[model samples]
Target: MNARQGAATSVHVASPPEFHAVTGRSFAAGTPTKSSQKSDDRLTTARLWQVRADPA
Candidate 1:
């Protein structure tokens, strides 16, 4: 995911390993943005959809 704040920009990936790494880097690099929360919500929703879509 790419986000732009004025002239600043950032990218976040929702995959494991890279996901953890990117989240840590984002926090350490600067103040957390509202988009982060939205991302978390999106990830959770995506996971739920994946679970529901799977065949039992």
Candidate 2:
């Protein structure tokens, strides 16, 4: 699906910091499956709310 389609299907789920951290770690570990890659692709292309680190 394209970015617009992905954005349309995406939900607004509030995740904790740990959730994002673990997901980042998992991707960093490079053991993602095809499904995981698809998920990652959706996330990257969709217009989703993300947790941004404080630039303090």
Candidate 3:
């Protein structure tokens, strides 16, 4: 590690144990969801995902 490195350009990840925090708030509506195939494939066929908020 050098002292002249760009330390301010790095992103910080702050997450606690037993839970993970993400920078996105959208849902995918294309796949059947995880079940037990042991496969790693994430593909969504939507342009936008809406998040409904309470009107109260």
Candidate 4:
């Protein structure tokens, strides 16, 4: 999911040795931003992905 999609209700991620190096912050919600529509450019460079679950 992109940051513009709003906060995720929940997330599950697999642990990697260098996970922290990629994601500067946890995948939690409520990140400071001028606009929610702003594309998360950091994610591209960081090479991080937002994990989500399939609908039940």
Winner by lDDT:
1
Q: Write the per-residue lDDT of candidate 1 for residues 1-56, one digit (tens) a residue.
A: 33464324333233335455444434323445445664568788798889999957
Q: Candidate 4, after superposition: displacement of residue 23 in Å?
A: 2.2
Between candidates 2 and 3, the one scoring higher on TM-score is 2
Runs of candidate 4 exceeding 4 Å displacement: 1-14, 24-37, 40-56
TM-scores, each model vs. reference: 0.27, 0.17, 0.13, 0.18
Our tally of clashes for model 4 stands at 0
Residue 28 C-alpha lDDT in model 1: 25
- Predicted structure 1: clash tally: 0
Residue pairs in collision within model 3: none
Judged by lDDT relative to the true structure, which candidate is superior, 2 or 3?
2
- Per-residue lDDT, model 2, residue 13, is 22
Candidate 4 collision pairs: none
For model 1, the run of ten residues with the poorest summed lDDT: 6-15
Candidate 2 wrongly placed segments (more than 4 Å) = 11-56
Write the residue-wise lDDT of candidate 4 on 1-56 in tens digits: 58635534223222444443544344544332243433457765344343333333
Worst 10 residues of 4 by lDDT: 7-16
What would the TM-score be for candidate 3 when compared with the true structure? 0.13
Which lDDT value does model 2 have at 50?
45
Give lDDT tens digits, candidate 3, residues 1-56: 45434332122122333224443322233212344332222332121222223333
